[model samples]
Target: MTRHLPARTCRDCGRNRPNHGRGLCRGCWLRQWRATNGRYDVATGTGMGGPGIPKTAADIAARLEDYAFLRALNVRRLDIAARLGVSYRTLNRYDARLRQQQDTA
Candidate 1:
């Protein structure tokens, strides 16, 4: 005799589906992951800049200024990255480029 397990429902929205993780369905799991891992707009269900931040020099410069302002106040780089809605690596690259520019100036 084979025993069958009942399908799992999302722990959040309660829609019946296979469990994605943490007892959540796929959509709920995605939402939860995005909310915690990125600057996810709840209403739109997407990230701040869709895919990633723009790579234009002006954009980078503005981000660098923000990073510097936060740093002057003694904010941690990880916290600043979260507050700015960018990844730590991206912020690090921006900082590196800013430093190079300052060195050359």
Candidate 2:
């Protein structure tokens, strides 16, 4: 028989319920993992940007998917690309895509 753990608020999702204190329940956390494709962890905050910061290619993809505002936000694309471990040309592509998306939406 499985033991029932106590409930708690998820620090990440901020939902009240039976959470195991990884700040999220197994299901929500699993969904988050799927969001990250199990390669990166935005929760523990690991990536190229720094400690608890996600900036790698995979991480960038995940962040872009989750936060459209980030795409529209005015930022130095070169700098962003430098930090993201990608080239300026690639950054331009991303920017173009974002602009197209923003324009359409």
* Top candidate by lDDT: 1
* Model 1: per-residue Cα lDDT over 5-81, one tens digit each: 45697789878887777998778888787767744232122244456534697776787899989988999877887
Please report, in order, the local distance difference test score of every candidate based on alpha carbons. 0.72, 0.58
Off by over 4 Å in 1: 1-50, 53-55
In order of appearance, the predictions have TM-scores of 0.49, 0.32
TM-score winner among the candidates? 1
Off by over 4 Å in 2: 1-60, 63-75
* Cα lDDT tens digits for candidate 2, 28-95: 88777666552322222233334543358887676455334444575565445545555445555666
Q: Give the TM-score of candidate 2.
A: 0.32
* Least well predicted 10-residue stretch by lDDT in candidate 1: 40-49
